[model samples]
Target chain A: MVLQILFIAIALAGVALFSYNLKKVIRNIRIGKAANRTDQPQKRMMTMVKVALGQTKMFFRPIPAFLHLIVYAGFVIINIEVLEIMIDGIFGTHRVFGGLGALYNFLIASFEILALGVWLGCAIFLVRRNIIKLKRFSGVEMTSWPRSDANYILITEILLMTAFLLMNAADAKLQAMGAAHYTAVGSFPVSQFLMNLLPNTEGALIAIERGCWWFHIIGIFGFLNYLPYSKHFHIMFAFPNTYFSNLEPKGEFSNMQSVTNEVKAMLDTSFTPPEPDGSKFGAKDVNDLTWVNLMNAYTCTECGRCTSVCPANITGKLLSPRKIMMDTRDRLEEVGKNIDKTGNGFDDGKSLIDTYISREEIWACTSCNACTQACPINIDPLAIITELRRYAVMEESQAPASINTMLGNIENNGAPWKYSPADRLNWAKES
Target chain B: MSEQLNFEVPTMAELLAKGEEPEILFWVGCAGSYDERAQKTTRDICKILHHVGMKYAVLGTEESCTGDPAKRAGNEFLFQMQAMTNIEVLNAYNIKKIVTGCPHCFNTIKNEYPGLGGTYEVIHHTQLIQDLINDGKLKAEGGESFKGKKITYHDPCYLGRGNGVYEAPRKALEVLDAQLVEMKRCKSNGLCCGAGGAQMFKEPEKGNKDINIERIEEALETQPEVIAASCPFCMTMLRDGVKLKDQDQNVQVLDIAEITARANGL
Candidate 1:
């Protein structure tokens, strides 16, 4: 009864803390401008299934994709066994689903094999990050916190998988000894190898099984709470992020309606522009960005796939797409905290442009869609870069000298160069 | 070098004045209008249209910039102003079908103009050439036979990744008698020519090397005698890179329309 009470309390606390943090994340994302991503529900559902569920884009790198598939599959399939553990934990019962006899044996045996796979997959990932030190994992933006966060997640999964196998091994030993409540129902295909490591005595065996059961459940709860704070938040945000994908041609940027209204008024004197709402011309900070853009920033997994394929980053430019996302999320979090301490009217003098992302970094982008195409989830970093550019040009009226010259040409002359509109047909006269 | 070939290219105003409307309008972008190298490509495109006996007319002096660079440079007001003016001219002519030599203009007119109450059936020049080949109106025979020569096509960003029109350009090239090679980064994964997003108007940001040089190195790896390009921006960048490497004598950068015109005896 005491064990059951302790299990119930821990489970409830875990879920409560996770829900609280999730609410804060949703609130922070909602702090941005409104965007209508709810159109075309069927198409959005298809995208979510293909990109997030199917993991189709991950196959671009075959080896890592295969390893990630194993870990992802194991995490999902092994969690089914967690359902049974939860039932047993709540009722103070031992292997409550073991009544199915042969079927239960098959299920437990499959889980043990998957647990083993998860162990090996996570071990290799650790070596790839720490020992081999892959270039993609060690960018300038990947400071100590991100590196340690990745290592912590991997190590925790490895430890949890270890506890799972040992728990099964001890339970198997207890079943053979005909100990009370230790039903001899499960088949140990992979965990049988660990039997030699466990003691043969019934009391020692019971303690090991209970200890592992507690450890695995508590570890999962702890991992759930850690997700929102780490890059692992992608595990939760990838689905919604992909579902809200920009379905237009990748080159087509969003038209600014505010600019349109003003331009229409300027071109046609009879045209009546709407009353000014005092909205800024473009995104100077997170509040100016669309909600979908904020969600995209949170969904970034920091894999550097976008940065790896970027032309600007490839040519040693200061711009890194992964860093852009990290900065957005960091700034959003800072904004969120300010709102929490002071009411919604809080202002922190710092904005996302000069304080976080530099003009040089945003300007270096080629507006090429490589970053958008390379994302496993359809995170559009180019969209945010263009938004920042719009703010710089339209609001601040500050652009590179040559760009200003080009804009001047387009304004005075009909072309980007110092040519007359009458000269447009000159190409036809040339032989 | 050859006999003089005389042909008349009509403008929409002249065609409309004659109580006639063209089947399609040719959108000769800024580069196609003023840039010396791109003008040659513009003439070849005109030559191909004349050879095929297709009724086409240009907007002439009435046409303005497509505001692609302005919009991309983050000046939405300038972009919309330019777009509204062009949209007014295109609507006045009641142009239904259009083709462009530059991918930037094609993409903007096809994709962006619709939001501002201007919609037309826009296509890149390569797509039109592909249609011409498929309909047997244009053929790569009885002209410059590139039978043994090797050629590689550089996919323009605004055409390939910007819009999904990879097969059209390649199909136009496939009609030629030359061998078509591919760079390591081609199709949807194509590298930018360093002149996109208003980069053509300004010098590139501080970097170890320019983007065009990186793309040029990948194209040179295929060892093709001719690097076929479709967009004028890409042509200028590739030509500059070839000159930098002193491979201009060895590598001849030509537009797809230019090559097709030569192959078809236009």
Candidate 2:
């Protein structure tokens, strides 16, 4: 009864903290401008299934993709065992679904195999990050915290899987000893090999099994709470990120409606422009960006696939797409904290422009869609860069000198060059 | 030096005044209009049109910039200004079908113009050429035969990845008797020619190497006699890269339209 009470309290607290963090994240994402991503529900659902569920894009890098698949599959399939654990924890029962006979045995056997897969997969990932030091994981933005966070998640997953296997091993030993409530219900293909290492005494075996059960459940609850603070948040956000991603032709940038209204008034004198809403021309900070962009920043897993493919970054430019996302999320977090303190809105006097992302970084982008194409979860760093550029050009009226000259020529002349409109047909007269 | 072919190119205004409408509008983008090297490509496209007996007319002086560079430069106000004016001229002509030699113009007219109440069927020159080949209107039998020569097709950013058009340009090449070689980065994975997104108008932000040089190295790896390009921006960039490598004597950079016109004896 005491064990059941402790289990219930820990489970409830874990869920409560996770819900609180999730709500905070959703609120931060909602602080940006509204966007219409709700159109085409069926298409969005299909994208979520293919990208998040099917894991199609990850196959671009075959080796890491295969390892990731094992970890992902193990995480999903092992959750069924977690469901059984939940029921057993709540009722103080041992192997409550063990009554399903052969089916339960099959499920346990497969889960044991998957736990081993997860262990192996995570161990390799740790070596790749720490020992081999993949270039993608060592960008300037990685710093100490992001690197440590990745290591922590991997280590925690391995520890949890270890506890799960050991729990099963102790339970198997107890079953063979003909102990009450042990019930000889599981078929442990992998864990059976582990049973010989466990102590043979009943009291020692029961203590090991119960200790592992408590440790496994508590570790999961801790992991659930750790997600929102780490890059691992992608596990939950990837579905919505892929679903809300841009579905139009990648080259087609969205038109500014505010600019359109003002242009119409300028071109046609009889046209009546709507009353000025006093909104800025383009994004000055997170508040000016669309909600989807904010969500994209939060959804970034810091994989650096986008940065790896960027032409600017490839040529040693200051721009890194991964850093852009990290900056956006960091700025959004600052804005969220300011709102919390003042209970109103952002007034930090520090915007996302010069304070976080630099002029050189945003300007270096080729506006190529390589980053968008390379992102496994479809996060668009180009959109954020363009938005910052828009703010610099339209609002501040500051652009590179050559770009200004080009715009002047387009305004006075019909073309980007100094040629006259009448000269447009001159090519036809040439041989 | 080549023989001068005499052909009459009609403008939309002239055709409409004569109580006639063209089957398609040839959107002569800025580069196609004024750039010296691109004018040669423009003439070849015209030659192909005349040979095929397709009724086409240009907007002539009435056609303005498509605002592709302006929009890409982050000046939405200037972009919309240019776009609205161009949309007005295109709408006035009641143009239903259009083809462009530049992928930038094709992408903007096809994708961006619709949001501003201007919608028309737009296609790149390569797509039209491919369709013409499929319909037996254009063939590579009468003109220059590339039987033993190797040629490579450089995918334009706005055409290949910008729009899903990997097959059309390759189809145009496949119709010729030449061997089509692919760069290490081709089609969907194509590298940019360093002239996209208004980069053509300005020097690139401090980098170790220019994007065009990077792409040119990849193209040169295939070791083809001719590098076939579709976009005028790409044509200029590729030609510059070939010149920089001093391979202009050994290698030739030709537009797809120019190549097709030579193949069909236009």
Candidate 3:
């Protein structure tokens, strides 16, 4: 009874801490401007199912994709076992669902099989990351904690899965020996093999079982808390991220409504336009962007698939789509921290445009939609790049000289050239 | 040869004054109206229109830019100004079923103009030619020059990826007895010509190689006698790249309209 109370206390504490951290991150993401992505719930939900749940985009590269699929399925399905763990902990009972008989046996067997797959998947991923040193994984942006974070998660997962199997094996052995609290219930097809190695002592068996059980649960709690700080946050955010992805035509740039309104007022003279809203033209800071943009930054997997397929990056330009997303997320986190330290109206005096993402990087983008297409989670890095460019040109008027000249030509000649409108038809004689 | 084909191309103002509504408005975009090489495409399209006897008129001096380059260059004010002016002229003429040789213009007018209340069914010239041939209104002469030539079609980024047009230009190429080759990256995965997003108006930033040179190198891999393009920007970039490699003399850079014009003995 004392043990049951202790287990419940620990579980509740872990969940409370996790929930607190999650709420803070959610508040941070909401600090950005309003956006209306509430339309087309059916389509959005369908996209979530296909892209996030079904792992549709991940299957582009067969080998890694297959391994990722195994790991992903294992991680999701193992949570069902965590539910049983919670129940068993709260009631202080061994095999709490053991009353279901054959059904309980099937569930245990399935969990064991999935745990084995996850173990193998993590092993292969470690080899691919540390040994093979995949180019995308080891890029300049991935040099420090990014690399370490990925390794840490994989190692943690391996340990947790190992602990789970060990606990199941020890419990099975104790049950076979007619131990007191250890019921002869459930199956362990894979872990049952490990029971032969354990000593046939009730005290030692209970210690092993309890140690593995505590380690597994504690590791899960640690992982739950680590998500907001790591790129692995995609595990939780990918579904909602894909759900809120841009459904418009890929090449269509969203028009600035203020400019559109001004043009409409000018064209239709009877309609009186309101004065300027005193808002900046485009995104110069994190707060200028829509909440969905902030969500996109937080959901980035940092997998560099977008960067790998980017023409600008492939051609050795300054732009890297992955870096753009990373910079946005970093700046957002910094802003969140500033607000936390000070009040909600705190000013960091550090903007995302020149402070973190340089003009050279912004200008190098080809706007080919390749990066967006390549993202596994449907993150649109190009939208962020375009928005920043909009801020640079429209807000600050700091566009490159050639772009300024082009804009001038458009203003004068109604085209991208310096030729007079009267001379527009001169090329007809050549035909 | 020019004296034999003197079709009277009327302006929208003239057509409107004559109390007539043409079947289509030929949006002779900036490139078609001003760029030297693209003017030939404009004329070829006109020649084909004459042959097909389709009632079409251009906006002439009243036509402004499509504001594609301006909008892409991040100057929303100038883009809106240009778009508003163009939309005003089109609405005044009550223009519908427009066609252009430029994908930039096609994409802008077809997609962006609707927001500004200038909506119309816009088609690229290749799509028009494909339809003409499909309807048996136009036919390519069998003994046309460059028959069975190894011709590879470059998918313009705006036309292919931006607007989902991959088959119209290919169908136009198929009208000739030419073998249509493809680059390593074609269709939905086709690389840009280093000219979209107003890159044509500025020199490429420091990189290992210009994107067009890379694209042209891919085209050369197919050993194509003719590099076919549907967008004038792609044509200009690919031609410049071919010239840089000193292969311009060997390989011809022609628009689909030009190819179709030649096939029809225009």
Candidate 4:
């Protein structure tokens, strides 16, 4: 009984710690150096429900998507049981599914089957990422990703799910043996059979079950805690990524809102121009962005959907929508660490774009919203691309030579063509 | 090239009472009043307005440019100033309706100008022309004689994607007995005339594909005798492309108004 109470106390402490860290990480992502969204909600909700759950976009390439879908759906259904396991397994009750005992047994049996399928699906993903070295994942780095990153990502996933399954197997054996003193796992068939193997060995079964339960909970929770700290934080990032989709009409550019202009109007009239000490117009780090854009950085599952459809990326430009997300993630970590150490924020001033995205990479985008449309979780790449363009044009006086020429023409002739405004009417008389 | 021409002007009251008080502000954009061959297209549009007896008012010099170029080139302030100037003029005349010959002006007035509180029903001149012809109020000549000569329509950016005026030009062409050979990139996918986004003012960016010339080549591919466009900017760019490619020996860039005028016996 004392052991059960102690286990509950530890679990409670861990949960609290996890929740606090999550809140902090989330805060850093949201208000960080991203641009303001101007997103449509109704369409976003439809897309989120359809793509995120229905896995519709995956059908664009069936095999890999189907494999991943298995894992995704398994995760969703298994989460309910995972919660129950955390409760009864830790507190030594073993009563969660006992009321409709047969139904409970069937649920566990089917879940175990799904888990195995998920494991196999993840393995296929591992092979594809490592062996195929898909071009979509290769952003403007001008070279392919090293094999180790893919392998590591694959191995990590394998470890996490394997530990979970093993932990389940260990506890189920204890339950099957009807051991009174140990944690009972809810994983089926094997646990039931193994428990019978040690029916008279309840002493042994109890010790093994307790060990397994702790490992399963600790390992999975540790991975959870590590998610925001890693590249695979897509596990947590997909939530806000879907929420902050562009509200503006699809294929239409955002009506550029000069927040600085608004702020100046509201602030002191003497508010000096060229605010060398003001909040950045575009993201320089994760913290300089809005909560949604920052969440995009964390949410990028590295699926490469955005990069694949990008005309600029396909035409050999240096812009990759995928890399933008990754770069945002990298900058967030760097800037977050700085804030932790010095407590200095963006208001005191810092270079934004150079710290976050490369100057050349910014000019390559054509502002296509394909990324948002193709995203399973409604990530908006075009918005980020435009924000960078805005910064480059407004703050840095750096725009494509073509854009500059176009601007000059507009200034001189009130048109993009070089013909004198006088000649503009020369065509009207000949018919 | 220069021309010796005889033209007639309709009185302001006659033009205004044709539609109603600002029901249609017959916007004579710069191209309509001044472009060499395109002026006939403009005059043709005016005669159609006269024949249809639609109540409309000419914006005259008050409607010179919608500042589409400035807005597209990232100079919103100038664009806004232009909008303010034009909107004030339109508002003063109680002009809540606009009919335009220029696609750029149409897009700017109908779409972009609304951001600055200028909102009204604006129809492209092609639409007006199509309506007049469809109603049998306007008549045309020489379509059978020109039947063997292939022609194609080029979509001006401001007319198509920049706004959403796609059908009227085609409808106008159909009434004129002109065959429209569609380029690979037509309608919403129409290539820029190497003129929008302020390309009209400066040299085009060095690209493997000069969008205007590329579009012209598409017209050439169809062996069209002329490239039909409603907007003056498209007309000018296409003309420049024809000249650049020396395709004017066979192909020509003609405004929608001109084609309709030919069919209307103006």
Candidate 5:
């Protein structure tokens, strides 16, 4: 009873801290301005099923996709065993689902096998990152904490999976010895071999079992809380981020409502022109971006797949879609930290543009939609790039001289050229 | 170059003055209106229309740019101004169906114009050519110059990935009776011509290689006798890329309209 109460208290505290951090992340994302993504609930749900649940886009590259599938399936299937552990911890029961007899054994055996698969998957991923040296994993922005964070997550998963098997192995040994409070009800298909390594004494068995149990559960709680600060948050946010993804044609640009209303007023001859809205034309900071854009930033996996297929990035341009997403998320974290330290509306001198993302990167994009299409989770880095470029031209008036000349020509000649509209048909004459 | 072309192109104003509404409005985009090389495509499309006996009229001096470059360059104010003027002109003519030889104009008129209250049935000239061939109105008979030639089609980003019209161009190419070759990257996975998003108006940023050069190298890998494209922007980019390799005399870069016009002995 005492052990059960202790476990309950520790679990409650961990969950409380996790909930607090999650709420803070949500609040920070909601700090972005509102945009209507609720118009197509049915289409959004289909997109979530296809991209997130089905893992449809991941299959574009086969080997990593297969390995990721094992990791993903293990992550999902092993959580069923976690539920039973939670119940056993709270109720002071030995293998609480042990009453189901054969069904219980089958579930335990499957969880043990999946735990092994998870361990192997993490081990291979670590090797791929460290030894094989894939080009996508190494980039200018992937240094320091981003690099170490990935390594840490994989190592942590390997450790937790090992701890799970150790606990099951120790328990199986204790059950075979006919010890007090030990249940021989569950099956251990994968961990059965580890029983020989465990000492054949009650004290040793209890200590190993208890230590692995605590470490496994505590490690899970720590990973849960660490997610919001890490790029691994894609495990939770990919579904919702892809669900709210833009469903319009890739080539079509969204017309700004302010620009539309102004144009409408101009077309209306009877109505006089109104004063321009004081609002900035495009995004100058995090607050100007929509909530979905903020969600995209949070859901980035930092895999660099988008950057790999990007024509601009492939041709050695400064523009990297992965870096664009990382900058947005980093700026969002900074803004969130600023608001947390000071009161609600604190001014951070740093803006997303010029400080984190340079104008050179923004102008380098060809808006080819390759990055958007290549993203496994449907995060539209192009959308953010376009908005930032809009700010650079409309708000800062810092476009390149060539672009400025093009814009000037459009404003003067109804075309992007020095020739007048009267000369448009000059080429139509016999040539 | 040996193809004989004959066509009497009428203006929209002339047709409207005669109390007639043509079946389609030919939106000769800025390139078709003023560019020397692109003007040949415009003439080829007109010749094809005459061969098929389809009544189509050009907007002539009344037409202006669709403002694709300005809009892509992030000049929304100028784009909207130009779009509104063109929409007013189009709505005045009561244009029901439109066709263009340029992908940029087709995309703007089909996708962007609807937002500005100028809705019309927009079709690319390649798609129209495909339909005409399918309807038995035009035929690629014995005079097919490209028959059995190794011809590969370069999918323009605007037509293929941006708009999902990949099959129409391929089907049009199938009419030439040529052995249609494909680059390693085609269709939805097609690379950009490095000219979209207003990149044509400015020089590319510091890079190891030009995107057009990379893309043209992929086309060259197929060892095609002719590299075909349907966009004026793509035509220019690939032509320059072919020239950079000094293969202009050996390998030809021609638009679909030019090929179709010659195949029909226009």
Candidate 6:
């Protein structure tokens, strides 16, 4: 019955991984199309490979990068151990190729080494996120963490990996008494020394080894299936998302979606902007934003580089580009839960200025490209901002009275100043 | 706004009847036309123009805002319209060469307007002064005019970051025998004067700290007596900031044009 259950569990885990990865791939395809990536296909592909395989931008802090590198390496190589466990669990055998086989013993030993490495890296990651105030983790307006999900995710990974390591140490003692020289299990000095205290030796040690293997396999599978619902979703999202990053030049504007006849029918006949009592032309909520932009709010790593370099934020203005991404993130998570239940998000279509972001925030941007440039991830807050401005100016006619007055004068006078066009070269003539 | 400051520049009739590469079309700019003190530099530059025997033309009451303010304030329509008019005026004159005292006008004509098809060979007057000094057409008169005063330059966006022209103004000041102090942020990262986007022509925004105010404070940190600048807008904003911050008790805002021209004794 135990063997039967193990096979069923392993089969279920494989199906879950396949399904989740496929869904993630589909979403990435949509994002790549939406960004209108027209750059050289080869260059983008090369960048994706380097960033994905290398975690290049992850090294902004070398410590985190170094720590993550060990775990990442272990995660890739330890797949052999997982496959061995799955085979052993399904067939009720200690080793499919026999414990005497060199390859099988090597893999078992390799996984123990990796488990130790992963434990060390995960402990540092937990400490860095928790005990230290990195400025990246400090929530604005609140002293405590605003989003607890990543914190919880980290804690859970730490607990599970630590327990898995303990399980390995326990197994190493049990395995060393047996004939198989599972490199780590047989060679570990402390475990080998500990194994001598047991009198019943052979039979009892084999039973202990078998039980520990089951625990290790189950813990790993549980973590794998739980990943899509956790903050570790970045593992799946980051690579493709990096590849599909907004390829539009820093200077070019994202073109407005052409209002189709279908969209016209969706609107009221008056063409007046949606009021508090009516649906807005702007996003009344998160659903109104472009889908990939909505994805960005969730995918944000919450690095404060955008806030640090914002021209508006620097000039003592209230607009924090980091906060802008955070705000959308908070809203989407809130509304996303509701959408799953009731099929609703931003139904009112109110402008972003009116509903989500304030008008004072909208006018504060210097269009300096500093915020977009500073962001480690390719989240273009400025592009989203200017798109909102384009809608307000051209479609909704909701630009601030001050900015519009300048626009009006320029529209009328050919210069923001009240000078005559014929006198353009007046300064050039020496009087 | 001061209508009394207009001047009569002797137009070079001979330069207009020229080959493709003429010597110079001295762009006096609105500030030079209106500010009485700025005229000192205007006259000195004109003398430099005359010294080279370079036939130079003037646009006499034909110059206006280069729409630098318009583009800065997100007023693209006004900027483009000005571009077209400027192109028409230049085409009519058959003018091929240019020099200007206004960095705003220099940036607009050379960078912004050309992108809209009003391309011209534009240079700031300080640049031309530096070039003339190099060619021995202009003299490096040191002691008397500068009077051992320390100077710090406020780089206007239109001149510095807008076009990456940093060296000429510093060279002009150095040659004219003034000490140069670097502001905390200068050149590419130079702060705005609370005035780039037509803000120079208008009242201040409700910023927690005015941009010009912040910039002036950084310049004051250098403890220079004179805040020398190359652009009219920077002159206006930095001067206002100095006054607002009460640093005018120790500092004075002067243009490179005024400084170089006074030192040159033109």
Once superposed on the true structure, which residue ranges of model 1 sit more than 4 Å away at CA? A344-346, B1-5
Compared with the true structure, what per-residue lDDT tens digits does model 6 show for residues A2-59? 7768577777876788687547534432321133554778776776676766777567
For candidate 3, the lDDT comes to: 0.86
- Name the lDDT value of residue B177 in candidate 2: 72
Model 2 lDDT tens row, A108-165: 9999999999999999999999999998898778999999999999999999999999
Per-model C-alpha lDDT, please? 0.91, 0.90, 0.86, 0.63, 0.87, 0.60
- Provide the lowest-lDDT 10-residue window in model 1 chain A: A339-348
- Which scores greater on TM-score, model 5 or model 6? 5
> How would you encode candidate 4's per-residue C-alpha lDDT over B57-91 as one tens digit per residue?
56543344676654554444445556666776676
Runs off by more than 4 Å, candidate 6: A1-35, A42-136, A139-146, A160-164, A179-299, A314-316, A329-351, A422-431, B1-208, B211-243, B248-266
DockQ of every candidate: 0.75, 0.76, 0.57, 0.15, 0.66, 0.15
lDDT of 6 at B41: 51
Residue clash pairs of candidate 3 = none
Question: Pick by lDDT: which candidate is best?
Answer: 1
| Candidate 4 Cα misplacement greater than 4 A, ranges | A1-10, A30-65, A141-154, A163-213, A251-291, A345-350, A400-402, B1-79, B82-86, B89-112, B121-266
Better of 3 and 5 by lDDT: 5
Error of 2 at B234 (Å): 1.7
TM-score of 2: 0.97
Candidate 2 per-residue C-alpha lDDT over B147-227 given as tens digits, one digit per residue, 9 for 90 to 100: 767999998888988898999988888888789999977887788888887889998889898888888888898999999
Worst 10 residues of 6 chain B by lDDT: B1-10
Per-candidate RMSD, Å: 1.4, 1.5, 2.4, 7.3, 1.9, 8.2
Q: Residue B241 CA error for candidate 6 (Å)?
A: 4.3
How many Å off is the CA of A309 in candidate 2?
Answer: 0.8
Stretches of candidate 3 off by over 4 Å are A196-200, A267-270, A344-346, B1-6, B133-140, B143-148, B174-178
Which has the better TM-score: candidate 2, or candidate 5?
Answer: 2
Which one wins by lDDT: 3 or 4? 3
Work out the TM-score per prediction.
0.98, 0.97, 0.94, 0.69, 0.96, 0.65
